[model samples]
Target: MGVLSGVKIIEMVGLGPGPFCGMLLADLGADVIAVERPAADAGNPRPWELCSRGKRSMVLDVKKPGAVETFLELIDGADALIEGMRPGVMERLGLGPEVCLARRPSLVYGRMTGWGQYGPLSQVAGHDANYVAVSGALWLATQSGQQPDAPPGLLGDVAGGALYLAIGLLAGILRARQDGQGQVVDAAMVDGSAHLLNFAISFLPDHYGGSFEKARPAALGMHWDRPYLCADGEWIVIQAVEPKFYAELIRRLGLDQDERFVNEQRNPAAWATLGDELSVLFKTKSRAEWTRLLEGTDTCFAPVLAPEEAAAHPHNIARDIYKTIDGVLQTAPAPRFSVTPSAELVSVPPRGAHTKDVLAELQINSKRTGDRGQATAVGSPG
Candidate 1:
């Protein structure tokens, strides 16, 4: 059991962020019912849909008769409901916040989207990159002369979208329990991405002419706060942002005596010159050599390890941060608790695998469902 042991949630499984939010809630021991499209791929569930882990899935085609009513039955008994359809889809399907809240006065309705409900772009379609790009969040990843790019889904989907919705739902549920009222939470990747940039914004006035549109920020321009390539072609990073840590970095590297490293740490004038020098210097040593000399020190150093390498890393192994489940490698649920730990990992299930059971539990009957309910699905995920 986990901290959210008794929480009840109904999730309308959609793309990326919505399923991820559901997975996170389930990981914390919420009793989650994932209402998926009837056409989802049950015969071939993808590994990344690890988002299905610990969730009980029900397949219901809202287009079919009695489907919306079935969902309402779930909503009536749930503490919260999450959905990621385009702004009006739920309304069109007759499962909007107003209707659900009427059914359950204290139900938390969480919506995840790229733009947000009522925004100019809310009804439009978008993916993770477009959301961050429009929010000015992608500029943080831009380096000199490089196009803005990042690992897909991390910034906008997982962080800005999924995580924000998860927390928003939890907060709403808490308030609902106390106040006996509920409201909808509009969690947009655009809004959350902009909020996530607040910390980097603090250093903006001294960076790139004080605007993200101009160029990279100050930290990227720092001599000691950059990635270096080793002779063996592996990459290593050091982000000694503080002065004392900067001193530790150069001293450990025996560059304290170097004239270029002697200047004030924020001196942008010295960055390019020192970067050129350090680039050549770092290439002289393999990553292993630098790991021995500087790793586990105050230099804020880390070697860039790919997923498999990260799983094999000593620190990661010691902390039990990564594990293989059903032959797919993924990180463990984060934000460790000293008291109630995260629930055990559960294997992914076929889509709509529990449709009959769920329908039976709710004693629901629709034209599309029978005593045994829908069969295993073979279509792709939504």
Candidate 2:
């Protein structure tokens, strides 16, 4: 059993972050039940959609007369509920936090959105790029004068939104277990993305003596810290921040005799020129040759491998960072525990695959609750 083996979560299935949060919980051993739309396209959730793994799926069309009540019944026994919708969408569906919390006093309600529930942009539509743009995260990704470019949707959706919502849900669950009072966790991509930028924001002023407006290209933009193309058109990145490591890197590259690199660590003006020189020098060797020379050294170097290439790398293979499940490649569950490591991932369920079993379990639970005079109403099939 995993650490969270007994925790139960009800996920109101939506796109992007909502499913991702459920996936995280499920991976950690929460019994996460995903309530998918009954009429959702069957061709959509392919096996490669890793977010749907380790979840029990059941279709419930809330627009049906009795479906809302059925959903609430599921909420009544759950420790937490995750929903990703606009500000008032849940309220319209009669499954809002207020109603769910009233029915289950200890329920941890996790709300995920691009802009929070009450912000000026709360009801406005947006995706990962737009949310990161508003949070000032997208701006930090650019060079001194280059246009900003985000790494697809990974930063804002998975890192900022889903991870924060999962953390908030877990924290709220702990508090509710102690005090028997539930609360809503408002997880907004805009807020979480801004929180993620705290490191860089503080580092700019405190460490670099620079502000965002007068942002000078620092370590991230410098030559030794970034990726350089190799002879075979592959790339490798090196970060030798400390003096010793930088000196070791220069020695390894036979650049100690170059006067242009001497004392260049202390000279910001020489960074660009040294970077260009290093760029030219790196292209003389293949990425594999550089990896052989620098990978295990204190110079802090790594080849820039693509997704498929990353899975095959010796280090990643040894660590089992990636697993192939039913012909689908996916990352393994992370932040492992010594006492109760997570189990191998189960197959993604088909929509409504567990409907009969879940409903039977709910019926048994309701009957037991009725014996104790605390029964909740369960809806009939629509």
* TM-score on alpha carbons, each prediction: 0.91, 0.91
Output the worst ten-in-a-row residue range by lDDT, candidate 1. Answer: 373-382
**Candidate 2 TM-score over all chains jointly:** 0.91
**Cα lDDT tens digits for candidate 1, 161-198:** 99999999999999999998999999999999989888
Badly placed stretches (over 4 Å) of model 2 are: 39-48, 213-221, 364-382
Per-model tally of clashing residue pairs: 0, 0
lDDT of 2 by residue, 13-50 (tens): 77679899999889998999987654333245442257
Candidate 1: C-alpha lDDT = 0.82
